[model samples]
Target: MPLTKEDVAGIADYARIALTPEELDEMTAYMNDAIDLLEPIRQYDLEGVEPTFHPIGDLSNVMAGDVPDTSVRALPLDAALRNAGSSRDRCFRVPSILGDQGGDR
Candidate 1:
């Protein structure tokens, strides 16, 4: 069934969105057009076809597995903190973006 303006308005209401009359009408047309485009797929005959979760089927990791290199050593804590503008308790300190609720981190 085609989407009506009222249906779109209801959806907008459910989503806590306030749409103008013109926007509601446009959204209704857009939703109906999308549904119409997919309507042709309903005519396909796939009685024995299994539903696929992944389009490419079962795929293993395509990237190379992680292999630790003993040649490369981790940077010392003192060296790592040397260039830091601010640090506290062996960790780099950054200004909290979540306001005073996050406290002084």
Candidate 2:
């Protein structure tokens, strides 16, 4: 089924997004188009195909492992916070980027 403007608007509202009427219409059309594109795949017959986790089968540690360097030691919390301009309860207290009204600062 094609997505309606109300459906798109509801999805936007659920995600805390503020979209104008024009944007809602555009997004609804776009989402429907994407769904239509994937509709052709439903006709394929794959009754016994096993579900795959990765597209390129059995990839083992493709990226470098996290091995800590022994030469450099981690700084203590006090030492780390020594140069900070403001701190509270063992944490850095930076100025709020979000305003009191929940808008941008």
Candidate 3:
């Protein structure tokens, strides 16, 4: 269904969006136009056509041999920790939110 200005305003209020009057009207028109455009698709005769699960051309799993390739570079611990907000012993540290870490449980 096409949305009304009141409907858009209600949604904006629910989402805590501060929309200007002009923006509200624009968004309402866009929402209504989207709904109106979709209406024609429902009238199509798609009775017997099997619903396609994936729209892209046929997909198949490309499998490879499980042999390990070891060209990946590992950064030094100190270099990796340079950009962290907090670190200890060359490791990035973060607040322990889980209670077990603080023995609070």
lDDT of the structure predicted as candidate 3? 0.83
Error of 2 at 72 (Å): 29
User: For candidate 1, which ten residues in a row score worst on lDDT?
Assistant: 96-105
Candidate 3 per-residue lDDT, tens place, 1-105, comes to 678889999999999998999999999999888888889899999989988888764676567878755687767677788889988775677777764564422
What is candidate 2's lDDT per residue for 1-105, written digit by digit as tens?
888898889999999999998898889999999999998898889899988999988987787769976689978889989999988778987778665766433
Maximum-TM-score candidate: 1
Cα lDDT of model 1 by residue, 1-105, tens digit: 897788999999999999999999889999999999998899999899999898788886678759866689978899999999899889998877777775667
Q: Write the number of the candidate with greater lDDT, choosing between 2 and 3.
A: 2
Sorted on lDDT, best first, the list reads 1, 2, 3
Q: Whose TM-score is higher: candidate 1's or candidate 3's? A: 1
Model 1, which residues run further than 4 Å from truth?
Answer: 68-105
Q: How close to the true structure is residue 18 of candidate 2, measured as C-alpha lDDT?
A: 97
Model 1: per-residue Cα lDDT at residue 80: 99
Q: Candidates' TM-scores?
A: 0.52, 0.49, 0.41
Give candidate 2's error at residue 64 in angstroms.
Answer: 7.1
Q: Score each candidate by Cα lDDT.
A: 0.88, 0.87, 0.83
Tell me model 1's lDDT, rounded to 2 decimals.
0.88
